[model samples]
Target: MENTVLIKNATVLPFTRQANGSLNLEPQIADVLIEGDRIAQVAPAIESAPPSASVIDAANHLLIPGFVNAHAHSMEILEKGNHEASPLELWMLYTYPPLQSQHLDARLCYLRTLIGAMEMVKYGGTTIQDDLLELPYVTPEIFDAVAQAYVDVGMRVSLSLHTINQPLHHTVPYLSDFLPADVKQDLEAAQGLSDDAWVDLFRQVYQKWQGYRGLVTTVLAPSASQRVTPDLMHRIATLSEEYDVPIHTHLLETKTQAITGPELYGESVVAYAKRHGILTHRTAIAHGVWLSTQDIELIAEAGATVIHNVVSNHRLCSGIAPIRELMDAGVNIALGSDGMSSNDSFNLFDVIKAAGLVHSAMDTSYDRYPKAADILKWATYGGARSALLHNEIGAIAPGMKADLVLYDLNTLSFTPRYQLPIHLVYAENGSSIRKVFINGQLVVDQGRVLTVNEADIVAELQDRLPEYAVHRKQILQQAERIRPAVEKMLSTAVSQSLSIHRFSRPLHYVS
Candidate 1:
């Protein structure tokens, strides 16, 4: 028998994309009916209820589609508040240093992922495109632990075997010239697992966990365009085609990357992706902060998505992305909080607020700024596109997956609310979220998770914090050996005179 649920007397944001590319977000008071894992109906009134249906009195509640965190790294949850803000390359040296040994046990992996998942659920996020990378390498045991964590939390994840085969210096610009011989030798000794080996590992993981329990799906992630060989990129493309899944990768996130793209590929990175048959509808490029006009056109023509990690962009000093230009060119845009190591939060509402406000500084014209409704759509529907689940989730309508969040309208965020969409974008944080449903299962209700012992997991992770802090200090001390070389590479890479500008000011600007 199919499980049924009926929610009564709630305000609904029935988000449906229209033919002209605008979202229909006209709010109305309605009742929602859920059967099994799909929305059965949404109407002004649901007159009859199924005999087996569980009912919830949702009076004075604001019902909306659950937010999708299109790009994130779940493993970085432990690194929150541990690192200082620096340029992308400099920060990565400590956060994901190649020389660090893999030290996390399988239980630690599970516990860390659970902390991230639980936070997202508490903040009204239902789906995450976890472009997850394990330091040094990924093992099947680690993969299973991560997947099990998501399933246990009752949230959705598009997990990727995100990795790179090229040497660390090869991926970063001017790194080879700056690294000392001893440091270079140390890095080479710590070279990653071979391309064939990772592919084999992914094949095993994909065969085991693709669409497991309707909560977890798999994607292929080559770390970036310049980070892998052309042959590996083609293989990744072919695998994506074979599995008919989305491909997630980093592209042009910093001015250093902007310089590296032309230096390595002899053209824009987007052009290189096109040459390798990687720019497609299934391709989602994270942090496209340095795209050119031509690059935007190619991505739009190929129907690729650019996930704007707005807060992380600013937090890492990567500079603002040309979001206004991307939106003008008809390219799909999604919002991501990035990893906790970078943005330090999983709250999509915070991301939505940032996405709405930050782009205004890029353009003086109010007309060109992102609309509140559009930003909300990017968080929901655009995120669904990034996950390749546009047809399945990201909306509140019949036949869509029953992933919804209900906010108490009586909350201060909605007090005397004038415009529903505007309040959602600017006023509301995660505090107003009273109930969250994923796959027709009420997993979070009134500030508590129903699926697992979140308090126990949080306690276990907290108990190990002192141990983890000691380990992090050791890693940072080891990383100090290479920090000067990385800083030199960053300075030299960003000093190059690229024709485009993503920085708030020109490279030569003096304070």
Candidate 2:
């Protein structure tokens, strides 16, 4: 007999929008049947359940498909609140250097990944696309540690070994000058090391972890167009094709890349990717904030997905992505919280609210932004599509993976609620997530994580915080000391730079 579970008497939010330009929010008390790891049935009020079935009463709760975080850096959770006042460029100097240098060890890396996954799961995110960029120091043990954490917590993960081949001399502004001339030359010569290293590393990781009980999978992550060469991009694309895995990358994230791509590569960054045949259905690009109209068109035509980290982009002042334009151009747009260090939170509801508000403010039209249902789709189906898991995950339909979140409507924020979807998007937060189920397993029940002891995890992090802080302070001091030189270098190199720019395009009111 198959293991069976039933969730009964819940308000089912199927994330399916109706043709009437309104959410399909009709309240129906239903029973969801889960057989093993998949949703077996969704019916309106089943009278009786099998004797072997475990029944969960989801009274006064909204049952929805679990959220999909399409792009993130889970390893940076420890660096949160370090660079709040810093802009993108300065933040990179002060904040990222510490992560790249001191905190790149195996223990801390796994701990951070665990904590990040904990935070995400607590907030109802079932699938996470983690762009693991600290690959230079990663090991199989570290990857296994992180993967085990995800499995223990009952969350799905698409893990990637992020690789960047650009020389430190070309990438870091002031740090290059600080190095001895000979050392700088040697570092420049090591530009291609990241590609070869990551190819081998990920090949090993994928072979070990790709189908590990269907809980973990691996992807090839070339950091970005500017950070990778054409040859490396082609190799990544080919490897993704060969293994039938997904490819994740950053694209047109900053104005600097958009403006400098023509000078460096004789074409726009999107054009460069296209020339190398890197854009495809299995590709998911994070933060297309500076992508032009033509770039958006090309990406849509290529059937690629873009993840919009609205809060993170706003916090870093990285400029707003043309989400309306991208959606209008038929680009699949998903929601991501980015790294906790940049966004300062791992809550997808916060991102959903921020996405709706930001786009509305930009377009000066209420209808131009995503509606409550649209945001729901972005967080669920759109996210699954971004990670190339649409067929297996995202929806709460029969045959889909049993990844579901139950949000309580009894909270103060959701009082007097007439609309379930709107309240979920605008009012809900981590505290409202009462239960979380991943792949037919109850990982979090009654607002507590069932896999690991929360107190012990917190205690461990508290014990390690001071050591991380010391290293963080040292790196920040170094960045501050070299700030003037970096600014000078940036000023001399880039003629036109915008600190905070906004772009707007008319969205066809989709109902």
Give the candidate number with the greatest TM-score. 1
Extract clashing residue pairs from model 1. none
Query: Which prediction has the highest lDDT against the true structure?
Result: 1
What are the TM-scores, per candidate, against the unseen true structure?
A: 0.97, 0.90
Cα lDDT listed for each candidate: 0.88, 0.77
List model 1 lDDT by residue over 1-511, tens digit each.
8879999998998888889987888988899999999999999899788788999889989999999999999879999877677788878877887787765777888999999999999999999999888878777888899999999999999998988777788877778987889888888788577888988988888899998888889989988888788999998899889989899999999888888877876888779888997889999999999999999999999999999999999888898999989998999999898999998889888889989898788766988889999999899999999989999999999999999999998989998888999999999998999999999899999999999998899999998888778878877886888888887877677678877788777543121
Q: Candidate 2: misplaced stretches above 4 Å? A: 1-3, 16-26, 98-103, 135-137, 169-194, 477-482, 492-511
For model 2 the TM-score comes to 0.90
Q: Pairing residues by index, what is the TM-score of model 1?
A: 0.97
Q: What would the per-residue lDDT of candidate 2 be over residues 1-511, giving only the tens digit for each residue?
A: 6668999989887765457433355667788999899998899886566788998888888898889999888767887775574345556666555224332556666677778888888899999998876633455666777777777676899998777777644543334655556545544554234567768877899888897887888988877776777898899889989998888998877666666566567777888888886788888999999888878888998999999998888776567888888878878889999988788778798998888777777745776777887787788888988888888887777889999888887887679878877887887776878888888888888878888887887788788888877877777775665456555545543445534345342111111
lDDT for 148 in candidate 2 is 75
Clashes of each: 0, 1
